[model samples]
Target: MSDIRDEMLRTLDRIVEANLTIAEREKADGNGPSAKLWAALTEQGMTALGETDSEIPFADAMALVARSGYHAVPVPLAETIMARRLLSRADIALPEGSITLAARAGGQANLVGVAYGGTAAHVVVADGDSLHLLQVTNAVVHNAYNQAGEPRDTIDLGKAKTIDRKPLAHATDVLIAEGALLRSVQLAGALSRTLEHCLTWVNDRVQFGKPIARFQAIQHAMAIMASEAAAARAAADMAVEASEKQADWFAVAVAKSRAGEAAGKTAAAAHAAFGAMGFTREHPLHYSTRRLWAWRDDFGSEVIWQSKIGQHMAAKGGENLWATLTEMN
Candidate 1:
């Protein structure tokens, strides 16, 4: 099974690299994923990994999303897979094109910062206890973009009518957990790529007739960046493993918190190493770093998840804390 997953991920990486180059990503930047890229992903059967019959296990599906992040592919395939699975479970006919998830509490009809909201054809919104499928075109979309130039639009559900509806208990919590896990895996992938860019920059840039990589301080910072990247990826892998079982909020909370923290550290280190070069739009480094910054805050920020972890530990008390924490999900 692991062999199959590795083969699939390698194949996915190839497809993404071949089809969505930095130039292509830029062509569709601030708008959404280009049609050509989406076509390539769909033709490769990369969109239905989470569906039971797709042969790709749910945990493996998470890995695919992480791989997409590595290439900085500007698409919401994570939401598309999860949304289709939810609709499938509800016996709702799946719609074509991309679908984004928007989970919110209470009866808030307006969803702020809906990832891929501007481009996706449909949105599966978990509004408190009920799930709603609405046409993105029907909604009043206030155009917006994240720091990475990915479409992060404000969707007004007030004007839109639900195409399908179903009762889903604890829908908000379920969707939030899903969002956090997906973002964490993505963060992990982006962190690794960011580290790679930093390493390459440090090795190539000359300082005082010597590569910056020769400097002890530079090497130390690079080492820390690598460690954070490794830890973030490990946390993401653990979260995916947890999905094979209960996939509770606790598992995703840990992953999101860790990965988000890693993103901050990794991005800062990359920018510091690259100096003014990293901050420029002409540099490829910003592609991954900006997404890392935006995604870490999307589902839930590291601060929010860290506080949740603390609160959960406090409730368990000191005696059972280690056992409970270790055993979570």
Candidate 2:
């Protein structure tokens, strides 16, 4: 697989992350990824991270996705990966350039949401039973942005001219689950990065000629944040393993729930450590914290996925619930 820098936090340190995610880049005019960076990524085959029915394993693809989140790399990478995988599964032609996936509900008239909405050249729309491939030029796009300065475009499919459409049963639901899984992993990533920033801040910020990390309360908060971040990362890895069979919602629900819950905790803990500095417009910490705040609510929020898990378990009854819990293993 063509890899992202080093698959480590320092990977983006090589690239100016602040430049990549500048708010100016997330504009209504349509903010595509930096052409130079895109070219480099494409040349390295990073754009093909999960293509070919994802001949690339989920673990590998998700690791890159997580890394992208860590740096708040503002591109439609995860969506592109899922979009390509969806197209390949239906034997459809894959379009060149960035491709994003958007799910249309049973009767929804327009493509409601997807990161990189107007920035992508193509889209794969899944509506429970089928997949429709579309060229962006064939549709009207209203550019918008998420809290993290990522593109969140709304596609006017009512006026779109489709390139191809094919029936792919349950694809819409699968995409939703997989999207949730992707976001969950991203949340975990940002949380980890946030904790790192917090740790550095507490260990370096001095008061009374002593680092704040020497204080008991700072140490306690750091421990809690570290644990939450670790749990979220563990959950992300577990979901990837479970979904090796398919885009299973059962696995995704657990991952999303844990990561979503951790997102808020980790962000709060991180900001608390940095105090006012973390919220400053120029601070790189906001990149990860803001993303953590937004991504937890994407795909499906903690409440939504947790409710789904509860409903499923309720229907399954006590004995079957235990079986289902261990089903992935």
Candidate 3:
């Protein structure tokens, strides 16, 4: 099983590296989700990983998602997978194209900062113990973009009609947990890519007849970036493992908080190492770094998750703190 998973991830990495070009990133800047990308992902069975008969593990699915982030692939791939999985849990038939999840309020749902919301065919909202499916056609959408230039729409369900409504198998907070986990995985991938780019640039760029990478100051900066990236990867790995074992909120919280903290530091270090070139639109480094900035705040920020962890610890008291920290997925 591990062999199969590794093979799949390697394949995905190649596919993303080959297809996710500068042109594709520019195309996605103001556009909705790409049909071509969706077709390719669906053909690879990447979109149906969470379906009942898909046979793909949750951890493997997240690994693919993280790879997508590494290449800075412009799509709502993560949201679509998460929406499909949640819909299945609620016994709702999954729709074609992109799908996103949201929370409903008072016969209406105002889903803010929804990735790929503008292009999604349907929206799944959990209201109390019921899950409601709403068509995108009926909703008023205010299209927006995040720091990464990815679509982050505000969907107004004030006048929308429900396509379907059914009893929910789990709480809506489950979506938040899963969303945070996904973002953490993506942040890790992007940070890794950012570090890679910085390393390459530093090694190639020379000053005073020597490579910048040879300088102690530059090497120190790269080391810090690498450390943050490593920490993020560890957090993402733990989160995915925990999710696969069963939804462990504590592990999820720790993963997001840790990864979120790493994301900011990694971005800052990458920029510092790369210098002015990293900030330019012509440079591809911004694609990874900007996404890192936007994603850290999505689902839940570091502050939010840190508070949750602190509250949980306080409730558990001091003696059990070590056990809680040492507990494995």
Q: Which candidate gets the maximum TM-score versus the true structure?
A: 1
lDDT: the better of candidates 1 and 2:
1
TM-scores, each model vs. reference: 0.94, 0.90, 0.93
- Candidates in order have lDDT scores of 0.83, 0.78, 0.80
TM-score of the candidate numbered 2?
A: 0.90
| Model 3 ranges off by over 4 Å | 105-109
Worst 10 residues of 2 by lDDT: 21-30
Candidate structures ordered by TM-score, highest first: 1, 3, 2
Pairs in steric clash, model 2: none
- Each prediction's number of clashing residue pairs: 0, 0, 0
TM-score of 3: 0.93
Model 1's lDDT to the true fold? 0.83
> Between candidates 1 and 2, which one is better according to TM-score?
1
